[model samples]
Target: MQNDASTHPEGPAASDTPATPDAPVAAFPTTRAKGCPFDPPAELTRLREERPLTRLRYPDGHVGWLATGHAAVRAILGDVRFSSRYELAHVPFDTGFTGELPPAPTGDMTGIDAPEHTRYRRLLAGKFTVRRMRLLTERVEQITTEHLDAMERRGPVVDLMEAYARPIPALMICELLGVPYADQDMFQRHVATSMTLSSSEEERAAAMVAIDEYMRKLVMGKRTTPTDDLLGDLTTSDLTDDELTGIGGFLLGAGLDTTANMIAFGTFALLSNPDQLAALRAEPGLVDQAVEELMRYATIAQTGLRAALEDVEVEGRLIRKGESVALSMEAANRDPARFPDPDRLDLRRKATGHLGFGHGIHQCLGQQLARVEMRVAFPALLTRFPTLRLAAAPEDVPLREGMNIYGVHELPVTWGEAGGA
Candidate 1:
């Protein structure tokens, strides 16, 4: 909505620290309260309400602006004046990480600015076009059906995260990358290890190396004997062996983690809100809307980081050059100004313009595929198990609190045998 920061409601000042007369500042990375796991940190909400573009003290001791308002967040992300160079930006939060960030790895687009980013984005863009992704609809449906059938055969109670959520995306990504079924377990092992927040830096680094080595070998195989998949098709392109390997690893990691989390988290959100779950079951047509709403409500990709490449005035605040800015997607998506009754998970709500997939040039490249997967998966799960409900208490559901991605670590669920549709 409103882009003018001055016009935003100025509530009480943030309590992180005292603000000087010249610069309004607060600490970055507020913690989410225990009972309010689904909601953004209360401090973020307060900062957004009082001063959406206030100064933040990064963990690395860099003071930069934190954009929590929907408009401010979008404005920063859309503006190329901001940098996405991973080494240039500080996370300003607990990552068990310290010291300066390393330069953007060979093919990780998340850590680079444009020109280079533009090149990779352009090369891969054609593969993810809406039409191409839509073509996968039948395949997605088949995949969803197979998983549901397996669940039916095996379950009275099960960890849906393992049985349903994790595998769907993992399998889809494997198919897309043309990874052999025989090697999927190995591929998936490295991926899971690399993404674990609890893993030591050395462990994570080793996992990445293993993943890259495998990708390099996979790319070489595709070069000699191509197949009909994203990676195989890319072999025809002029990309170098190393570049192809990097891109392959990047896509596999991105495609698998985010969507898998959304599926598990979406199920948790709906189960917690029985009325919304019922609405989806009663009206299967609501699946599309529910997907967007759940993405908005879950806001799984909690925050985005950027550094000002040059001084720029945004949302009426002056952000100096070289300062890292953190955009709180979770907060902005739930901003009351943008979405009324933002906390309520109304499946019927026309939740357009959500930052769930983000916005701007670096917005998720695999969004269409993720949407198609969700559009099919969510409804199918509900339809297959009408009486599906959580077996664990809501509070006991383990969440990935300190992880880079926000989601449940596991979701135990059960359903009546006769409830299948």
Candidate 2:
């Protein structure tokens, strides 16, 4: 992959209007905006109706198209024209370090496209199959109970993020990866640092190196005494050591933050929408529908990075080959064309398909695991603490700024005693 810094694409000429620029013209915001791009802009509905494809200037001055309309966003994700392999391009954001990171000790499966992506994904498919996820349901429930139980002892007002949101997924992933329970702290620390969007380049690099080293050692140990864990399964398969490490890294990198954000953001959503919360509390069976709605509304993966494989015309705009583009899933989720009253959080909405988990061949492999986690976490949470409410003002809560994944930095919540329901 080429690392030519000068390859950054130039922005298009400015337009007259501030709110929505006309097609075939690039418009740069005067100052960088923090938080998720989907933070419900004051004029988003108007912008969607007027300008579906708007030019966005990245913090690094790299220019790309941001697709806002639901149909357009879905086309970009599902179309063969747009490619996820953009490590070679001088894009500002990191695409989950799928490539452009140091050579994977195990070759990276995320960097490769299908047949190869399909093959590697297939090997691990069984691990995340519905049956496997069903087996994990009890363990997940237990983990959820433990977190809530701990919160009860310490609570009144609790940082739900620290007390519940972070640990449940962290513990579940540790269990699934077969990493020793005692070593979870070490792994969690590494995963936390490695996944930080606010960290500097040096800090991120250091974290990645530390995680790689840890995985290498774990892979070496598994090679000799393989167990029934996911790591052990990969080790015993036809995968190379490097391949094994890559899979492990992929799981570590993908699993924790996304699910953590889901827990945090989902909690915030539930609290902010009391009616929805009460509805779920009244009918606990709505957990599945509620999770889907949260995924659609929250859309933690705010922007996906992709490069134009070849010069392609999309929605009447010409995209040059190799130019980087941000597939704004958040914008797509709220597009009125796909979802009527897209802004409202409706639990009964017929969510046929959403780009919350992405689309096409490169869709998320751990989606099943994510669904299971949410399915277990939400219902149990509502049932455990029926009176759960936000401890902080919604406007005052600090959100993760300028990160690929949209999540709150902290979610302070209050609930009744553990098992109070």
> Could you say which candidate leads in lDDT?
1
Q: What is the lDDT of residue 292 in candidate 1?
A: 92
- Give model 1's TM-score versus the native structure: 0.92
Query: Distance (Å) between predicted and true CA of 84, model 1?
Result: 0.3
lDDT of 2: 0.70
Q: What local lDDT score does residue 235 receive in model 1, on the 0 to 100 scale?
A: 91
Alpha-carbon shift of residue 211 in model 1 (angstroms): 0.9
lDDT of 1 at 353: 91
For all candidates in order, the CA lDDT equals 0.81, 0.70
Total clashes for model 2: 3
Tens-place lDDT per residue, model 2, 1-421, is 1111223233543221222244422332212234333345434444567767666554445566666777777777777766555342434444333233332234455455566677888898888888888788888888889888988788678888888887877787877887766676676666666555656667766876887888888989999998888898788789888678877877866766789888898888878778888898999888888888888987887666556666677787766665655555777788888888888888878776888888877677788888888998898888888788877778667776555566787888876654442
Q: Which segments of candidate 2 are over 4 A away from where they belong?
A: 1-38, 42-47, 56-63, 90-110, 417-421
The sequence of per-residue lDDT tens digits that candidate 1 reaches over residues 34-118 is 7677899888888889877778776555566789999899999899998777766666665566755566668888777779899
